[model samples]
Target chain A: MRTITKNGVRIDDTFAEAFPMRGTALILTGPNKRWARQAAVTMTGFATSVIGCGCEASIDGEVEARDTPDGRPGVRVLIFAMSSNDLQTQLVNRVGQCVLTSPGSACFSDLVAADALKVGDLLRYFGDGWQISKKFGNRHFWRVPVMDGEFLCEATTGFTKGAVGGGNLLICGADYEKTLRAAEAAVEAMNEVRDAIMPFPGGIVRSGSKVGSKYKALHASTNDAFCPSLRGMTKTALDDDIGCVLEIVIDGLTEAAVADATRAGLAAIIKLGPRNGARRVSAGNYGGKLGPFHFHLKDLLA
Target chain B: MTLVLTLKVTPPQRLDLSVLLPHLLADKSSKDVAAIDLATTREKITVGDLFRIRAGSAEEIRFEGGSERFDGVGQGLQQGRIFVAGDAGINAGRQMTGGDLVISGNVGPYAGSAMTGGRLEILGNAGDFLGAPREGELNGMSGGLLVLRGAAGRRAGDRLRRGTILIEGDAGDWLGSRLIAGTLIVLGRVGVSPGYLMRRGTIVLAKPPALASTFVDCGQFASSFPAVFGRFLLPESRGAARLFRAPLRKFAGDMAVLGKGEIFVPA
Candidate 1:
């Protein structure tokens, strides 16, 4: 790939290819902001990649009490899956296990779309016939009796079918610390953009993967091409000077959002420059034929 | 264009003005609307006989004047707007699936009965049976909103199946009697025996009332539902939602009936 140097960081011309996915957002409210964020953080835990975790999720943003429907502090969470059915399944399971059990927590839909996932509609059975339903305007909600008090949840949450997933940035540095710093900076910048989320822990992916594995049963395995230790043993994508590589994967409610996040993250890394030990920036994709969305790093700089 | 109907004279007997519904009056000219027949206990009087009709589109029909005898003012209205500048008769906005009905003055008994969907705002006092089911219907006020800015007579919200009733002023005796399922929020004092034989529903009272022996005190607990419910009600009223704060006392009872109904008051 052709490379251009800017702000002391190498920018590859390669693009990140992303697939279309189903995504939804929910607002989890609690008596205070801490509890609401706790529930959101718990529900979004272990949801890093769709290949293994069945979904990708993270806290999109924080909402003030006045901005929320429940008049309580809330956390907005975004979830993405390969299909609508899987999205619904993951949402119901996560909300029921995490938010429902949370004390004084209530869930609401932050997204409004024609397609919907029935979270509270199925969770109400936990009430054992004691659940109460209330409807105001076109929206409906269910109040299920819980040990703490009641778990109030909206009947359905809206989902977008045209979500973009797997938008990424590959950061190569002179050392591990610099690579980590670059990834951290990129994550911080990307987080400011709405409608997108990085599902990884601390928003950095240390163990990135490729589509298939050498093992017969495994659908994916670690990406060895960029491995510093495997550079000599395999056809490596890394240069001799590179010491470490880390990636940031993003999923967004729309293609534009993913594009915006990708541009913002790349800009942040470049701004950090070589003084931060940042060496090069690139993106991973399968021959440009897999995913429909192509976010070219060079074009983003343009 | 807006249809304006001004009552020429106060009729002696209660008139079944349900025919004034949008569907019947829609797409009619001034001559056509004037010839429309209205049902009464005696001979069927034409619309031209009682009111002066300035015809326009049925999308928004206004009554320049109203009376207690103007029964079923906006009944069975599927969609459109009906504004009664003065008092309305019984069952105003009754059984309406959708629309906005504004009664600027008082209404007789059975106001907003058996409404499946719509908005009914009575600016003045309501006689009795507000949001109550009709004589034989199994459910009352199953869907829709009933907002009474003034006081209501006895049995307000009797047999309410589903929907919401917000009373800004005091409500008379037997309020929410036989309430099946729904929410009734009263900002002022409620008369004796609210939720008398209620099967299932919620009655939120601003002022605690005398309870019957059949009711059991459920104690006060911090409930966050009021916050959510209150936010949902902001579009309807400015102060109605503020009445639903947490830490309110709960009472489950009417053991004489199904016993699932609850009454909540400030602890």
Candidate 2:
């Protein structure tokens, strides 16, 4: 199949396959947006992947004061786990340690539907018998009397099957500077698309990994094939002109989410293709051997 | 003034008089209000066959004649006022959310359970769990006010979250047990464990208890009572501004749990 190239950028034929996982979202609010971001960053810390951290979470977006329950600046965080029980455990621990510990901060469940199982109902006993449960409208919230008045958290959280590792695109440029620029542009484009998150440092991954390491103790190692400096020594796939490669991994809750992110990333990269030394943009795949669903880059861009 | 339909005789079996409150009969005329449906001894009876129907507005309702076994007279009434001249049966003013319900005589058990808002003033004695929860429910009397002129049976104002319960006379044991919030003012002596497992809110007692184990004396200070009760407690001619008193004794307790709630015994 002929790969689609837009403005001298190569769109790989392979797709980023994803799998279904249980997910929950939390809303954290404080006196201002700064405190809200503080609590959010702490709550979603060390939650990049389920393989080691037991969950994958990130700040989905920021919410306005009117959208919050207590009329404060807040952020929406989405957490995904392998199962419902694991999701509940990780949520209880993270929320208890991060959001509840923060002064003038309150946590609430973003998902209001009934399917969300409750985790706060059991954790409320930390109030040490002083916890008060209030049912407003159809939602039940627990008021754990803290030092600063009360820490009101939703009694339950709504759960749904969300797509993980959905849309991933790797950028291979003429040099490190060009590759970094291309990846940064792709991240900005993907950020414009809703319902998608690139849960990594700066939305760019320099140390791309394969499924397993050469050593017996490690599960994953660096992708040496994509390394331009070690081209002749190792089984390298990059051409002579391609000097640097950076990966942009995207995960969303639905198929449209992956397609939208892919479209945005491609659009942004193509827009900056002339000035930047960006050579080509491709995708990472294991020959359709990993996750179930896939988002073909060419099909998504078209 | 809504008309009240009083049963002339107390039947052998239990009666359900939940339909006889003023708010339930608010839209009906005085004559039609008196002709409400009643279930007595497994038989349906009309109001015209029982007591007289006086013509008035739906604001006030007066019940007379029957002194034995009248049940659920003002259950779940949200507005208007109800006055029972003689003794009432079981579940009088049960779950009353708003308006006023005044019973001149004694009342049976479970009065004002699950009441979200309203006022229930009983001039005579009351049965068990007055202003308390049903058998298994967790919360009781989230809002509104409940006043008992005479004594009340066990577990009065149990697990109350909001509102005030003022009792002029003595109260039974385990009063205000597991109170979540709100104020319970017992003008008379209270039984043991008055504020058990109380997390927050104030509970004021006029008289002290003989034994003191759970509650710890926090401090003595005054509290401002809300001004809305003057119109309800005093005569109609007097305005609601005259009922201002300060410096109430504040004693915090049920410290065995969180030690946040207070019990103010009048100094």
Candidate 3:
């Protein structure tokens, strides 16, 4: 494979390692955009990774009022987990606590066809016999009474198979400021890609990890191969002039989505060129031992 | 495509055509459809005797001529859609399970009685015991959606166990009387004794109705419950949707019974 270079930026001939994950999409609506967005943000908060929260979630996009079930301002959110059971647990807990508690907010499933999990069925207990169940079209919804009024939620949410999680792009630059700027631009561009979400804070992950740690009990540790501090002690993947590094982690409903987001992010960073300190773009993989989906950098941007 | 049944002559007495649902005739040919039995006042009669039948595979079945003497229009319907062109008699949709039933004109008593599932839309008025179960049965309209565009007679949604009934016009006395569990939304004026002996269910009244002595006012407050409930009504009518979006006065009552039923009036 031939490497592509734009100005001083090098596109590595590597691939991102992704594993199969279970996930579901939810639509949260409110009387207004502010309340809807607040509910969505709260539901996706503290959900950066399955390592800490047992799920990864983020606001995917905004929905038009006419398109929603209630003609209210709404947002689309996606949550992914390693297992379907874990995904369901996270979905019920987060929605029950965040969306059901939000004033004038309602939660709905975004999937049209798939195996469904009973999200609202489990949460309706909070209504304490006051709950009302409604069947509209082909879907069932629950109306749980609350202080703000009632929280309407779909009874079930659908999940699909072969969803890719943990695809990444490592941005290395000449200095901290330039590298960070390019990474920020890349994150912004990736956010526009459909069906994919960057789960880390601001869509950038600084503490990139490897499969194992020096401590026996740890499953993952810092990526010493790319760490600037460990460059002298370890066989570093970066060059001598590389001063700053940032990683963008992507999780998507499909491998194609992850690849598209990666290609978009790389193009956005490449557009910044050497002047912005974008030196090279690489990816993280565990020597083909990680997972099934592999998004090659060269083939993606080709 | 639609299966059209147009009456050729007026009937002297009531004709039980409840077997004329979409599910029964969807796959049948015109010749086969016309052979279906209809019990009239005089004797058992074939559908071809008094009406013309044009058949197709479409899920929609339309009755073209006036059917003032026709009864049990969609009884035991399991699937498909039904459209009645004119007035129909009693027991229009008894024990309906699934599908959509639309009546362009008025229907007599026991409309949507014991309906288990599906949607029934009455463009005109309905008679007594709308969505009510039969005398021997314990539940009425266990599941389904019943929308009445015009006024309803007494005892609307009586003993309803499940399902939703939306009345665009006024409801007569005993609205939702003895409701077991279900939702009855009256967009227009409601008559006396609304929610009487209700055990558990929801009654949304656009125009406040006179409550029984057993009820207790829960106080008027700003709420979003109506907005949520209103969304479900959007597909039925825009007026109904708007009726539920505003603040409402809620009353928990039918205290004479189990007392879990609630009535919400637009504030």
Best by lDDT: 1
lDDT tens digits by residue: candidate 2, A167-256: 588888988888898899889878877667777777777877778987999998888988877899999878777899998877776667
Give every collision pair in model 3: B18-B72
Could you give the fnat of all candidates in order? 0.51, 0.00, 0.29
Question: What is the lDDT, from 0 to 100, of the residue A182 in candidate 2?
Answer: 87
Cα distance off (Å), candidate 2, residue A2? 2.6
> What range of 10 consecutive residues in model 2 chain B has the weakest lDDT sum?
B222-231
lDDT (CA) per prediction: 0.89, 0.74, 0.86
Model 1 achieves a DockQ score of 0.59
On TM-score, the candidate that comes out on top is 1
| Per-residue C-alpha lDDT of model 2 across residues B167-197, encoded as one tens digit per residue | 7788888888888886676766788878777
User: How would you encode candidate 3's per-residue C-alpha lDDT over A158-188 as one tens digit per residue?
Assistant: 8877678999999999888999999999988
Summing lDDT over every window of 10 consecutive residues in candidate 1 chain A, give the lowest-scoring window.
A130-139
Q: How much does candidate 2 score in TM-score?
A: 0.64
Off by over 4 Å in 3: A30-35, A64-68, A102-104, B221-223
Model 2 clashing residue pairs (backbone): A116-A157, A116-A158, B1-B57, B1-B58, B97-B117, B97-B118, B222-B247, B222-B248
DockQ, per model, reads 0.59, 0.06, 0.36
CA lDDT of A54 in candidate 1? Answer: 93
